[model samples]
Target: MNRVITVRELIEVGGFDETAVLAGETFLEKELLGVTSFDSPDGHKWLRPGEFVLTTGFPFLTHKESSESGLIKLIDDLVEVGTPGLAIKLGRYIESLPPKVITHALNRQMPILSFPMEKAWSDVIVPVVRYINDKQRMELVQTHAIYERFHRHLTSGDPVSNLIPLLHDVLQSPISIHVPTLKWNWETPPAMRKDETIVYVDKQIGQHAPRWMLNQPLARMTNGLFVRWLLHDQKVQGAILLRQPDRDLYAWEKVAIEQSAALLSLEMERQRTVSETYQRFRNDFLQLLVSGKYGSRHMLIRKAEEVGWELAEHYIAVVISVKPHSSPDVETWKENLTLLETIRRILSMCDLPILFGLDQHNRILLLMPATENDESAAKGILTDLMTTLALQWQHPVYLGIGRLHHSWEGIVQSYHEAQISFRSATHAIGLANAPLLHMKDFNELGLERILFADKPGAEAHALAEEYLGKIAQYDKEKNGQLLYTLQIFLQVNGNYVEAANLLFVHKNTIKYRLQLIRDLTGLHPENGQDQLMLRIAMTVHSFGYQA
Candidate 1:
């Protein structure tokens, strides 16, 4: 709690006769000026005007050579050097301030004050200094307390449930800490309305929020305040918004909240990292199950249960299939994952806990607790989620949901069922036309083995050889020009000028070769579906098609 001593407080404490001297009404120790002990001018070069300088006017101003003109000139020089105000000792100086000096100070509004002849300058300055030092010390203590609370909550391994209570205790208010990152369909806060007293600390996010809770007068004026603090250390990690009662929060309180938020942000990141590691292991475990390595799945379930998930709970498997309109590379997939993580985080806000695992088949499986307690509401929530994701990513995704099962033993069965439904949804009439698919049809499970098959190495090799054989024949017949053009075009994703530059040919030459390839293979690179097939074919030819 930094004490802001007003000019009035200074006058009262210093025993200055207000009638004899005038002080600027706006002078503040923390804002307009800061007080520092001036023992020597040796190391205080950065001191400038607008800052009140403290001194006894002792050694230099005492000599006869330092006449009234010299004294006035010294004040003038200090002011000229950006010293907005000055504090002087009265007893050591000539009995009283000269009329000329007072008049000069009054005209410039440069505040000058005299301490009581008996009161030492050090005594007057000490209280203000002490106040500031004590404030800083208290802030340090509060910061430590915040970290302790945060560490306890995070290490206890329950974040969302513990966060509100921990923050409420620290802020001394009923805090609602809303993480937009964790709510998939959550709307962004809108611009603040008039008569709003909420403060926003915004982090850099690519998208804007569409709604603001502080926009309501009741929410805004109920002594309720909003604060946004950026998570400085993490890339793509969103901000923390603290909404507390509008009781005056001084510098120390603000510092404490900000520090606590920073700690929470770091802990959230750590938890995310641990979750990702667990998901990766889960993914590997599930893949082993699919590959008939049942022992690995059993081991992984044991390890996961140790980490807090109740393996015996009824769970449902959901498989998310993302078929890029055009074939996407690894970098594209990584960028998409950032957005997917945001969506997953949002879904976690619901009472149901979700665990995400990515399989070798490029499917995202979410293991959610199976209770039809609010199945309709959950579906509505999921529909909004799909819509939001489609709008955000500008691509379509298909979802397959499997029936609920009793335990971890049934996960593989549900997963296979979900995969079948995923394929059936992608192929059925009117179903394939829809942007989102809920696997309500259980009969789709019959095609599970055929839909998701693990091809032998020989069969995969044969397919690759057949595709490349055609491409090689086309290239040889055209003197290797077609293959060369295809390489450059695909590298640039069929951008003419870029491909031309890479091939050291005119854009027209590259375009002509692309047209020639289309004529030879009956595959138009301009069509997204054809382009995707060609891209996959090119990749398989270049790198053997084994996961």
Candidate 2:
């Protein structure tokens, strides 16, 4: 808080008590920070904002032009420089302010006051400067006290949430804290939840958190909202918002908000450090579970309970990864952690016995309690959750669930199955249009499950070449899609019209391609044996491209 005096207050002082307003009376509330007496023609250029200028109108009197337009131009320069007001001694160098000058000043809302010619400039300068210094000293003392109060809370190890009430009391108004990157928010009464204006602002903050966090503190927004950014390690981590319904916030209130923001930043950093440490330990425990390293069932259960994980008789493994084409930026370790935490936060609402961590491949791994009756509900929850995550991340997400199994050994088997299903999920995306959530279950993989289980070897390569290699080579040489047509034909169960529709070609074109495939591969799409061989070969051949 600067604690500067306003023109309205300045006029109540001893030397200014006899002064009269010549124009722009309504803007007397403009703050006056300093006093200056200058007669240089260009001295206004050097004047700082909030300074009150005292002139005898001599700059205009001795200048080349010394006309009404010249005085009006001087007023314009002063107004442009953001001077609080002008105090001009009258009936000395100039008879009176020109009517045009008064009108211009009035139009610009620049305060113009007439000083009494009898009083010397020293009378106003000396006392006004002393008064400003005294107010500044008071401001420093008050701000220091506010800092001490906030520091006490910080040293006491209080969380960021506990500081909101203190800030609200200081501002004497409703307030909100929003940390969109972490999906965190808090508000005092007259909840921001119901305010559509503030909600829209929050949405904006969510979409542009990385960029908006660096914005200046105390930035004004719609509906009398003042935002002070919470910065940590030079990054904007969150924001503290103050709402003034009936009036603007005072300078001192803003000072308190700033101090509170610093405390919030420190507390949030502390929370993040604690969270990361817990995640590291949890990750180690997950690695142990998936690796089957625990000594016995009883020991595993005890270890799980320590991390708030409830061991269930039956569990299913789920793996989540980002779609390849979803983003161009390399997924850094920090981003992966953010994605993992996001999944945990969303899944915690399901009230199921669930354990979350990163797999050996650095993808999100989940061990969700599975019961025969609740499997469908769990899948539904995952589908909806993945869809929500996709929207939140602004990209498609891949999800894979393994078959449910019993006991510790089953957890390891299900985890391996999940890794296989995770691969299938990525391939499934290429088989159709990309949905926001691409999900696959190991049990539902059908014939592809066998192909995924079989490692690529001499036998697999020979089978692929014996079945569809010629057709693939022909399509490549002729710039054709015969191999693709056969696959689509098998996919639609030999419906020529359906295959043609999926391929976006004429039905006749589909028949022509199938004929070419048969001619080139000596296999037919309508024959059950031939179709099985062709599908298996195509599935195996696709594996050659998987990472």
- Candidate-wise lDDT, in order: 0.55, 0.73
In the range 1-547, model 2's lDDT, one tens digit per residue, is 3538888777876357544888888888788788888877888988998889988887787553347876788888988898878888888777777788888999988988888888888888888888888877876787777778787877888777777787877677888887755555778874566466555554443233455456665677766677776665454456777777644555667778878777666667777888778777788888898888889888988888777677777778898877432233456445666677667655643444678887666777888776753567666666676665675566656777887766667788788777767777777753243365677897665445446553545434555775577777786788888777877888889998899899999999988888887787667778876677677777777888221
Candidate 1 deviant stretches above 4 angstroms: 1-9, 17-46, 53-266, 281-329, 350-356, 363-381, 390-547
Best by lDDT: 2
User: TM-score per candidate, in order?
Assistant: 0.44, 0.71
lDDT string, candidate 1, 1-547, tens digits: 2434445555555456765243433432323234654644332355754445666555345553324565466566666666656666666655666777766666555677765567666676776566556656776777677667666766777745455556556665544443544441221132223223212321223243334522321123344555443332233334434455433455555655565566666666767788778767777755654444556656766766755554435556666755522234675456446545656644654444666666675567666555543334434555566655554444456567665544566667667656656665555443343444333333333323233334433333443454446667877776667766786688887799988888898999987877876776667766776676566556666775431
Residue 89, model 2: Cα distance from true site in angstroms: 3.2
By TM-score, who's the top model here? 2
